[model samples]
Target: MHFHGTEVRQQALTLLRGGSENAEVARRLNVPLGTISYWKHVDRAKRGEPVATRPSLLCPLCHRRPLDDSAYAYLLGLYLGDGHISHYAKHHVPSLAITLDDGWPGIQDQAETALRAVFPHNATCRVRTKGAHNIKVYFKHLPCLFPQHGPGKKHDRKIALEPWQQEIVDAHPWDFVRGLIHSDGCRITNWTTRLVRGERKRYEYPRYFFTNKSDDIRELFTDTLDKLGITWTHCTRNGNPFNISVARKASVALMDTHIGPKY
Candidate 1:
């Protein structure tokens, strides 16, 4: 008798548990109906749960599985900066979506790559809008990876990472910083003419600015910067410290090394 691999079986179980009908799951996964039914039976028996089953093996939060270090770190930063985890009515699985500027196709590719790396079994896609692209993927366990998903907007709620997430960011700090910079931050050069010994010379300043409304999110960004030995300051916007600026030459050099521009 031919049998599906364990990964395929686990994927089928997840789809079946996510309110998908037997025939739909079978068709979507290209698995035989009889095999799908058998997998469901075994999963139900093992879990001792009703129709709705627990998260499949892909959920690191539920299964204590190890995540792709660089991918998770980068995705976490993007999530806190500009990404959103959308909730829906019952029976509809949640989605993790990160909005990227269309001008930077490279960043879009990176976001898609990170999504695929994080959820190798799930499908990733991109939706184009007026001036940007939303790279998203549907997964029932998105909330398991990003615990910060909540009822209100990210800026309106407190954003904090779980211990395990923090560990990944600590390990791959550069990737995390790159994600944040590519999302809500930017690198620009400001030039001013200065008087030299003979003729006027143009003086230029290169700096990075990360803007986010949530205090907790800003703190998280700064905390990561401190660990990386990067200096930053609170750049006041509308009379409030809403933007984190890394303008020091040494720190800016370090940031340029890891994350130049959005491109």
Candidate 2:
């Protein structure tokens, strides 16, 4: 929800300096209008071009204290997998919420840890909804945390990382992958039967599988795998919902080393 990255600040400055109106720039960039106005004031002050009162540009989460790269990357993956950002028109409040099955207390704890790491100033609360627990972070700039947000299911919309987000994910690929797997993937032992010289044999092996309806999300998962030298395959069951499987023994071992089994 906070804009801490230098890249995002630079982009806002460029757009404002190019004569884009504040509201239009904010709409186009999906940033809060206050954020764009704050940057514009900063630019004018720097150029001695002058004017109104100087409002503080410091964001509590982003400026006073910032999230570490690892935490941010993990949270990003979790959001992409099972999170959503909501804006209420009446109250004009934006919140980032990650929903997890109520059964997985460990996963809920991990998500809480990541959220707390990002917003130490704010308390992370868990609300029960239906059969899931929702971890919510209320902030004005929630969209900044998830620039890929749009209307409807993720698969029906395009998902792409901003430059700053890409840098964060690139630096902490393992953590990102761990978050993705923790949210939507699993490590399990699969068994199959084979006939060997008129005898039947059963063997068990460990493999990892991740399923997501979004093509872009799937691609992001596989791209991270490729970067980490992990091998994976695209698979389909029945007719819908794509999956990626890391079934090769060596690859599975490598993933185990990095992601292990979720606690």
Pick the lDDT winner. Answer: 1
**Clash pairs, model 2 backbone:** none
Off by over 4 Å in 1: 1-57, 198-200, 237-240
The window of 10 residues in a row where model 2 has the poorest summed lDDT is: 53-62
lDDT of 2: 0.83
| CA RMSD per model (angstroms) | 8.0, 12.0
RMSD to the native, candidate 2? 12.0
- lDDT tens per residue, model 1, 1-263: 56679898889989988988888889988899988987888888889866543433358777666678899899888888879888777638888889888889999999999998888878899998889999999998888888899988888877788888888888999998888888889998977898899899999999899988888988888999999999999888678678999999999999988889877
Q: How many residue pairs clash per model? A: 0, 0
State which candidate has the highest TM-score: 1
